[model samples]
Structures are given as structure tokens and as C-alpha cells.
Target: MNNFYKNYSGIILLLGGIILGSIAGLVFGKDVVALKPIGDIFLNLLFTAVIPLVFFSVASAIAGISKTNKLSRMMGIMVIVFLATVLISAFLTIMAVRLFPIHEQLQALKITEKIEDKPLADQLTQLFTTDEFYQLLSRRSMLAMIIFSVLIGFATLRAREKASGFVRFLNEGNEVFKHVFILIMKLGPIGLGAYFAYQVGVFGPQLFGAYAKSLGLYYGFGIFYFFALFSVYAFVAGGIRGFKRYWANNIIPSATAIGTCSSIANIPANLNAAKKIGVPDYITNVTIPLGATLHKDGSSISSIVKMAVVFALFGRDFNSADAILLALGMTVLVSIVEGGIPNGGYVGELLFISAYGFPPEALPPAMIIGTLVDPLATLLNSTGDTVAAMLVARFSEGKNWMDVKEAA
Candidate 1:
């Protein structure tokens, strides 16, 4: 009972809050909006930590990589695999959007237009911030911060001894914030509950009705892609019997991912699943960790879907050849910085705004769809990590990967 509560308390609280909040909404109508402040406070608390959390997490992730030659080869192969999968995933997403286009029903709802147009050169320059401190203070450019953190991490790797102290400090800083972040996550029940209550209370069922097609399409496509692509990869690597064995071993990581909705949080489970599936310790240790931070096939797919939907709603020509190509490339590039994205795909929404110039008004429904399907995305992400590790092991170490597999 204790363990069950421990595991499910957040879901329980969220459901309770929503139920009660909805009742209040129905009974009291707009008066129920008084509860909005509770959710706002919680969101503010989480947002407070976003900048530092992203900065330290990215920096520490890079700094943790050792300056070893073999590991370098492993990282290179891992990246190649990661990009290969991302490119394929992105293309699939674009194609899916083009095929099952969302209808023009949402055109009735007027959306806010709050985008600032800039010259191509100026837009390009904005990606890299000029003043680090100013950027940090303003919280304006997450890409710039991510870029800087990665550089610092690489520098520490190259100047091992000279920068050892600084690296240690960064590691310590990350740990401290990580603990704080965990504590903040403990407030999920109250935060998400209040937020959902306010949302459902105000918008009613029509809110969900608005995004039904987009959500349905994303989830449906995600499942198909995961099974289809993962099955193919497993079959290629280990044949029929091996494919069955691989999926059998990967059940735990897949479940952990859906439960936690976080790839980074599923590291231990992924590592365990990797071991069960016979990924070497060396490969799992480096590749799984890095993959969690970098690989975001699930997020990429959802982002593309959201972008396509938003573009269509705003009367943009999303199906044009140039638009499709830009969307594909942007998915890959935005995915690289996905680590900095806040939960519920908020940062991803910003990426759409910046990359494709989608209107800010269209963000709410897109976010709603992203939040609804996050579990599916995380499931793909977590399971994909383990699969990627297997691929990395097979590619880096040759086809004898499963020879070391323990017999069933």
C-alpha cells in the first residue's frame, strides 16, 4: 500500500484536484477561477529554477564525458546513430502531417498575432548571444546558453587537469540544483492539479475537443513509428528470435518511461534494461546517459506535428517544398537543444515560434496536445535510448553483440 501510494500519489492528487476543480467550475462558474493563483504560484516556482537547471544540467552532462579515445569513438558512433534516427523520425513526422492534414475548423477561433519580424541576417545572429551575463539575466536565448555550456564542457574535457577544479564545481552545482529540482517535482500533484483544474474549468470539454485530431494523430503515429522502426532495427541486428528477446527485455524501461515521463529520470531503468538485453557496461554507461540528454526522437515527432498543425491553423503554407525541408532540418536542430526545454514541451513551443514563426496565439492548443501525449513521447525516448545503445554496441563492436546475451 505504501509503495503504491508512493508511486501513484501524484496521479491521485492531480485527479482529485481536477475532479473537485471541475465541480467547482460547474457549480460556481467563473468564481472557480479564484483557484488559478494556486497553480500560478506552483508554475512560477518551477520556472524559477528553469534557467539554472538547464544551464548546469547541460554543462555537467558534457563535463562528465571523460577524455578517453575509445569513448570518443563511442560518442561519434552514438551521434551518427542518433542523427540517423532523428532525420528519419523528422521526415516521417513531416510526411504524416502532410498526409493527414488537420481540417480548417479551427479557423473560426481568432488567435493572437504577436510575432516580430526580423531580417534573415539578424535572425541568424540572434541564435548566438553576444553577452553571456546579459543573456542569462534576460533568459532570452536558451540556445546560446546551451551552446556556451557545451563549449565549457568540451574545454574541461580537453584541459582535464587545468580545469579540473572548475569542472568539479560545475558538477557540484548541478547536483545541488538537481536535488532542488526533485523537491520541486514533488509538488507536481498540486501544480498540475491546479493548472488542469483551471484549464478544464475555464475551457470545459471544448478545450480537449479543439485538439482531438492533433492529439490523436500524434499518438497514433508515434506508436506505429516506435513499433515499426524499433522492430526493424531489432530484426536487422538479431533476427526474429533476437527481436522477441530484445522486446521482452526492454519492457521495464518502456514502462518506467511512461510512468516518469522523463528520459533522464529513466536512466537507471534504461541501464538495467540495457544490461538485460546484453549491452556492454561501457556502451550503456556512456551511450545511454548521453542519449537521454541528446536523443529526442519522440519530442521531434510531436514537435513536427504541433508545428504542422499550428502552421495550417495560422494560414501558413506548411506543405510547400521549402517549408517541409525547413521543418525537417529545424526538427533536428531544435532537438539538439531539447534538453533545455521545460516539461509539457513548453520550450519546444518556443522553438516553433522562433524557427517557423508560428503565432503565439496558436501555442496554447499545441501545448495542450504536447502535454497530453508526453508519456508516449517519453516512452519512445526511453525505449529508443536502450535500442540506440544496442545499435551502438552492435555497430561499434560488431554483430557478435548478442553472443554475450545470457540464455533465456
Candidate 2:
């Protein structure tokens, strides 16, 4: 019972809050719009705090990596595998949204108009870098800030002992912001509750149907990815034997991912499973730990789905080739900086809205979908790391990695 409560408490509170807010809307009708300020206050707090939160967390996540680990063959292969799987998962989700149509098809949003006036090359340049550093300090240029943070991390890596104190500062800052985020989330039950009340009041209940439909698509595809996609990854790593070995040892890790809803939490299980599946310790140690934060097929899917839902809600054309490509790339980045902390998906959602120039109202629904889809998403996310370890081992240790382990 204690474990159950500990694992499920957040979902319960969030759901309870939404339920209460929805009730208030049904009962109070348009008068519930009075609660809009309360919701705004919550959004304001999140937006204000998230800028530093992202900078510090992302910088530190990168800074903590050992320089030796940064230059290895294992790192390169792991990165390729991560990107490949993320692209596959993201494209899958995009296709699913098209075939099923989770929300009512609507016209493109105003942002699409802006996209037409700007040249593609110029827009790409601006997305990656800012004209000035001060611009990165704002959420409007999140991609720039992330790029800068990554550079800082790499720079710190190069500085070695000379930058020890600064490295400590980055790590400490990451911890501080994590706690700060926790404090902010204490208001979630109330804040999100009020926001939902405002949503139901102002937007009508039709949006709820969209939420239900999207959530269903996410869960359905998540399960398929877990069972089918993972099998294929394992098969690539070790052929028929590797496929059998993967299923033999992966159940506990998969279970932990679902139960905890955290990739970080599933690390030990992944490590143990990888060892059993004969991944070299060198490969297991790096991929599982890095994959906890960096490699996330599940979050990739979630990000694509979140982007589509936001587009649909705003009457935007999600099917545009440019939008699809941008969404695919953003999924990879979102998977990179998505902290392994509680409510971390909030940062990713914030990045989505800001990157696309969506108004603040789009945030709540994305966040709610994240909450609803988290369990299965984490399952795909955490287990994929172990599978990635298999791929890395296959590359690093040769095609007969499993046989080599037995022979050794």
C-alpha cells in the first residue's frame, strides 16, 4: 500500500485536481471563468522559473559527463542509435495522427503565415543561434539557449581540472532548480485545477473529446512500440539468439519503468538486464546512464503527438512538410534535455509552445497529455536504453558479442 501510494500519488492528485476543476466548471458555468487568474498565476510561475531551470539542468547534464566517455566509439554508435530510434518513433506517431485524426481538422495558425514570409535557410539559422546572447535568456529562444548550454557543457569538458569549480556550480545549480521545480508543482493541484476550470468554461467541453482520443492513440502505439519495435532492435543486435535473450531478461526492467514512470529510476534494472543479455559493462554503463536523460524514444513519440495536438487545437496545419520536419527535429532535442526529474516533461512542453510561438494556453493540454501518457511512455523510454546498449555492444564488440561473452 505504501509503495502503491508513493508511485501513484502524483497522478492521483493531478487527476483529482482536474476532476475538481471540471466539476467547478460544470456547476459554475461561465462564472468559473473567474478562476482564470488563478490558472494564469500558475502558468506565470512555471514560465518564469523554467528559463533558469532549463539552462542549469541542461548544462549540468552535459557537464557531468567524463571527457574520456565523450570521445569513445561507444558514444558515437549510441548517438546514431538514439537518433534513428527517435526518428522512427516520431514518424510513427505523426503517421498515426494523420490516419486517425485525433482532433477536428482546422486551418493553419498565424505562425504558418510568418513561416512563409521568411526564407527557410534564414529561419534555420535563427532557430539554432540568436543575434545576441541576451535573447537566449528568454523562453522565446529556447533552441538557442539549449545550443548554448550544450556548448558550455562541451567547453567545461575541454577545460578539465581548470573548470572544476564551475562544473560544481553547474551541477549544484541543476539540483537547486530541481527542488525549485518541486516547490512550484505543489501548486499544480490548485493551479492546473483552476486552469482546467477555465478551459472547460471558456472553450466548451468538446476539447475533452480530443484529449481522450489523443491519449488513446498514444497508449495504443506505445504498447506496440514496446513489444514490436524493441524486438527488432534486439534482433539487430544479436540475431535470433539476441532476440530471445532480450525478452528473457527484460521483463523486470520494463515493469520498473511502468511502475516508476521514470527512466532514471529504471537504470539499475536496465544495467542488470543488459549484463544478462551480454552487453559489455563498458557499453551498459554509458548507454543506460546517458540514455536515462539523452535517449528517449517514448518522449520522441510524446513530443510529436503533443505538437500535433497543439497544432490542431490552434487550427494549425500539422501536415505541412516543414512542420513535420521541424516536429521530428524537435522530438530529438526534447528527448535530449528532458530531465529525469518529476514534472520534467513540463520543461519539454514549455519548449514546444515557445519554439512554435504558441500562446500560453496551449501548455495545459500538452502537460495533461504528458501526465496521462507517462506510464507507458516511460516504459518505452527506459527499455529502449537497454536495447540501445545491445546495439552498441553489437557495434563495439562485433556481431558475435553474445557468443564472445559466453566464450570468454
Candidate 3:
């Protein structure tokens, strides 16, 4: 029974939640108001473990790196790969949005009045102001949290003899936190059910139609965009044959992430897939774990795409300069600066919107759009991580394409 549950639990929970939520929504559509608190509670519970979990995981993982030089090299490659993928995703999303504009009969969708765009300097000032800065960090802002975690981790590593006992304690604590996280994740079905039920009850079927057309387009575009990006990494690391085999082995992890919409929860599967694809244990253990935190191709793409969608909704055309700048800037910013901190997506989205001067009312709609695309985003992010792991393995093994092919 334990083995059976381990094998099929995610699928059962996800489908069951969707089906039950749909039924409950149909029956209690008018009473969604009552379900709001339940959904909120689930979200609160889900996020409650994020901070401690991240702090320990990151600190331990970094401190556990045996050597500073190897750690730096691994991180360097990871950063480069992360940035490249993000840029490609962002560019593809921008093009797709332009070609398949979300609003065709733009006149139908009400355009909220534009807010005054904040200057970059002012926004930076606000971002760094002591109170605001503390709030961002306290809230587990992914970017800030990551920065703090990395600093502490590095400091702990340098402390070496002085902090050996403390580091050991943190490593143990990280493991304990992971166990707690696993326990919480097992309750995902209930939380998803409650959240979905609330959404259905509050909005009814009418809400589906509201952004159905735009969402459909975005989903289709995202699918194409992801495949294109995946292909590039596969080809660079290995040829078509290698790529096919690599992808086949990775399907389980990719599929799980898509269904669960949580990369962290899918880490075990991802690690397994990496090893299956011949990625070394060292590379897989380190890169895959870290990638789960920092490499969010899906989130980055969706953010840029949503920005374009918002622009279209407001009947504003993004000229080439604006489009290129937004895509490149967002990709670079998200890849390097955005830490795999808890609730990083929401924080990044809010900051993006505020910086661009998008209307306040636009946030709700943007969030709604994000929910629909989040699964795909998770898929892209997980897939990208696998690909990066493959690259790292290739480089570390000192194997060329010919060598890889011959080995296969």
C-alpha cells in the first residue's frame, strides 16, 4: 500500500481534486463566499513552510559543497544556462504574444485606466528603503531571501572550523525541514480541492469565459515556445538520438511537475531522471537541487507574456524597442537576481507591474492568467533543469558529442 501510494498518489490527488472541486462548485456555486477562508487557509498553510524550508535547504546545500572552486564553477555554469534559457523563453513568449495577440476584439474587454509609471530610480529607492526592504525580506521575497541565504551559506562555509558544529546542526535541520515539507505536500489534494472549489463557487462558469480565449492562445503559444527551447538544449548537449533518449527518461519528472505545478515537490523524481539520463550523482544532486530554486523558465516566460497581454488589453502596441527591452531585461533580471525564495513569483510579478506602471486592477486578472499557465511554466522550468544537468554532466565528464554517442 505504501509503494502503491507512492507511485500513484500525485495522479490520484490531482485528478480527484479537480473532479471533486468541479462537482462542489456546481452544487454550491452561490456559496463560494463561505469557501474563501478555507482556500486562504490552505494557501497560508502551503506557504507557511516556505521560508524555513528554503533557508535550511540553501544554506546546507551550499555549505556542503566540498570545495569553493568547484562550487563557484558549478554555480557559474548554472547561472549561464539559467540566463540563456530565460532569455530564449522570454523572446519566444513576446513573439507569440505579438503574433497571436490576446485581444482580437479588444474593444470588448474593459481597459482599466493606466497608472503613472514609476521611474527606475524611484522604484529602486523604494525597493531599498529600510522599511520596505525589511518587509520584502520578512515576507520571504524570493529575490531577497535568496540573497540572504546565499550570503549566510557562504559565510558559514568560510567559518569552517569556527562554525563546524553550527553547520552540522543546519545540515540536520535542513533534512528535518524537508521531512516536514514532504508531509505537507501529501495534503496537496485537499488544499487544491478547497482552492479550486472556492474559485468555481465565487466566479461560477462565467469566470471561465472571461479570459478563455486569451488563455487558450497563451497555452498554445507556451507549448510551442517550450518545445523550441527544449530542442536547443538537447541539440547542444547531444544530437537528435541522444535528445530523444534524454527526453524519454525525463518525461516522468516533466509530467509530474506539470500535473502537480510544484517543482520542489517533484525533486525526487527529477533527481532520479537525471541519474537515469547518465548525469553524474554529483552533478544531479547539486545542480538539480539548486536549479529547482533558481531556474524558473516558466514563471519568467509567463510574466513577460502576461505583460504583453496587458498591453494588448489596453490597446497599446509594444514597439520593437519596448518588446526587446522588456523581454531581455525581464529574462536577465529574473534569472540572476530572482532567488528561488518562497512566493517569488508573486513578488516578482508585483514588482514588474509596479515598475511598468500597469494599473492596480490589472493584477487580479494577471494572477488569474498566471494560474492557468502555471502548470506549463512548471513543466518548462523542470525540463530546463534536466537539460542543464545534462550540460553540466557533459562538461564535467569531459565528454564530447562523439564520446557521448559512442558511449550510447
Candidate 4:
């Protein structure tokens, strides 16, 4: 029963939200716009907690690492896997979008533009200059935050005794922030309902149908993309049997993520899944929590694919240089920097458009599109977490689980 609840809670919430949203739209209709501020308040509450939560959690995790070499190896493997997963997911999504082609003949939606324009040269300069560069690297901007967190974690280790007190404080702070995050998550369904209603009320449900086929295609591709990448990683690290066991245990986390469309909210379920899969507490404590914030396979895929679609929408043929730059830029910004925050991907997409000097009017439509797609992406992201945790556990145990299974 406990396992069933975990596995199905997300589906229940998602279905509930949709039902409620549709009812709200039918009744209140245009008046649903009034709910915008309430939804915004919830989003603000979630966002307000992100920066501190990230800093403390990362710092404490780093401080807890007892051996520099072990930490380095773990981090090396984590980064490589993260990037590779993201790139593969992105490549597949791009292909799906091209082949399936959502809204091929539909006119672009006109909405209030939130993007800021700059000359192409200026945009390039912004991407490279020291101040802007640091923003991306440090993740003070969405793209820089992950880089900054990793650096701070490593630096805390170097600080050793000098930073011990600070590290302890960070740990304490992480606990407090976690409590706050929980409080916000409890209100998520309501927030989602309100936001969805407001969106439908303002734009009308017809808008979704305008690209309904595309949206459906996106979701379908996202599901396949997740399983394909995770299957390979699981087989490589955990063997087929271990992989099967891992998935069996992780159903709840995957369901919860799909329902809530928030990876952070799925942390408890993920940790529980990790424990059930026989991962060490230290590994689960460190990786699951960190993964909630930094590992965003689903969001990375969506961001990259969306960017490609956006370019195609504008009838701009992407040259090799353009595609490479955009992919690298997105890999840094979407996958790493904005990995953990609630609605982080939506904000990152806006920044991507702004930084690229795309028309500001594109933002509102992008937001609308991204919001609709986020839940599906979040599900994929959570599934990736399970796959990653299993792999990490296999590697850390210093046994070739995959080979053992093969021999069996």
C-alpha cells in the first residue's frame, strides 16, 4: 500500500490538477486571471528558497567528503554522465521534433514579449566577456549557478579546518531550507491548478489544441528519450537484473515527479527508492539531494529541443557554429546551472532568448509552451536520477555489478 501510494500519487495529482483546472476554466473563465497573483506568490515562495537551499546543501555535501581523491573521482564520473545523458537526450529530442514537427503550418502565437534585444555582436560578447562570463560560470545567472555551487563545494574542502564552522552552519541552514521547501511543495497542487486555470483563461484552451499534436509528440518523445538513455546507463553500471530492480523501486519517485512537475518535491521519494535499491546512506544522502538540484536530464532535453524549434520557427538555418554554440551554451545553462530550482527551466528559457537577442515577444509564447511541457520533462528528469543513483552505487561499491550479472 505504501509503495502503491508513492508510485501513484503523482498520477493522481496530475489528473486532479487537470480536472480542477478544466472546471475552474469553465466556471470562472476570464475571471480566472484574478488567480494569477496567487499562483505568482506560490512561485515566488518556491524561487525565494532556491538560492540559499542550493548553497547550503552543496557546501555541506562538499564538506562531508573525507577524501579529496574519492570526491574528485565521484565528481568526474557525475559530470561526465550528466553531460553525456543531456547531450544524448537533446540529440534524440531534436530529431523527434524535426521528424514529427509540431504545429508545422500554424502561425506563431502573439503574446507580450519578455525578451530583451541586443545586437548579435553584443550577444556574442556577452557570452564571452568576464563579467557576463562569470555570471554564467558562477550561476548568479541561471547558467552560472551550478558551476558556482560545484566550485564552492570544492573550495569548502580546501578550506578544511578554516571553513569547518562555516560548513557546519551551512548544514544547519540546509535543514532549515529543506523544511521550507517542503512547506512550499505541499501547496504545489493548488499552485499548479491556479496557474493552469489562469493560463487557459487568458489564452483559451484552443491554444493548446493549436499545437496539441506537437505537444503530444513532445511528451511521447520525452518518455522514449528517458527510457532509452536510462536503459543504457543501467545496463552499463548495474547489469540487467540490477537495473530491473532499480526501476521497480523507483516507480514512486518517477510518478511523483510526473505529477508535481518538480524534481525537488520528489526528493523524499527518490531517497526512499535509493534506500530500497540498497544504496548506502552516504551515497543517497549526497547524490539524491544533489541530483535534485543539479541533475536535470529532462529539462536539458526540453531546453535544447525548444531552442532548435525556436530557430526553425524563425526560419533561421543553423550553421555548425550556431548549433555548437547553442548546444554548449544550453548544456552549461540549462543542464548544470539551472538544474535544481522550481520553474528554473522556464526562467532559463527566457534568459536564453534574451541572451541570444531574440525578439522579446517570443518569451510569452515560450513560457506558455514550456509550462505545458514541464511536467513531462520533470518525469524524465526524475527517472534519470534513479538511473544515475544506481550507476553511482555500482561504481562506488568497487564491484562490477554488470559483469557479475552477465556471468549469472
Best model number under lDDT: 2
TM-score of model 3 vs. true structure = 0.65
Q: Which residue pairs in model 1 clash with each other?
A: none
Q: Rank order by TM-score, top first?
A: 2, 1, 4, 3
Model 4's number of clashes is 6
TM-scores across all candidates?
0.79, 0.95, 0.65, 0.66
Model 3: how far residue 202 lies from native, Å: 14
Instruction: Give the local distance difference test score of model 3.
Output: 0.63
Estimate the lDDT of model 2.
0.84
List, residue by residue over 1-408, the lDDT tens digit for candidate 1: 685566446446555655665566666665656777776676566556656766776787777777778687888888888898888888988778768775344453344455554554565566555565666533446556667878878878778888888888888987787667667756655665565556566656544444778888888999998899988877766677558867998888887776666778889988988887787889999888788868888988987887766775566666666667667766765566555222535555555554454443454455456666777888887788888888888888778777865542
lDDT to native, each model: 0.70, 0.84, 0.63, 0.64
Q: Write candidate 3's Cα lDDT for 286-393 as tens digits.
A: 888778777778777777766765565555555457545755675554543333322235434544554455544344445556655666777777777888887766
Model 4: lDDT of residue 178? 68
Lowest lDDT block of 10, candidate 4: 137-146
RMSD of each: 4.3, 2.4, 6.1, 6.0
Residue 6 of model 1, lDDT score = 61
Off-target runs (Cα >4 Å) in candidate 4 are: 1-69, 103-124, 131-157, 160-210, 312-321, 339-342, 396-399, 402-408
By summed lDDT, the worst window of 10 consecutive residues in model 2 runs over 108-117
Question: Which consecutive 10 residues in model 1 have the weakest lDDT in total?
Answer: 103-112
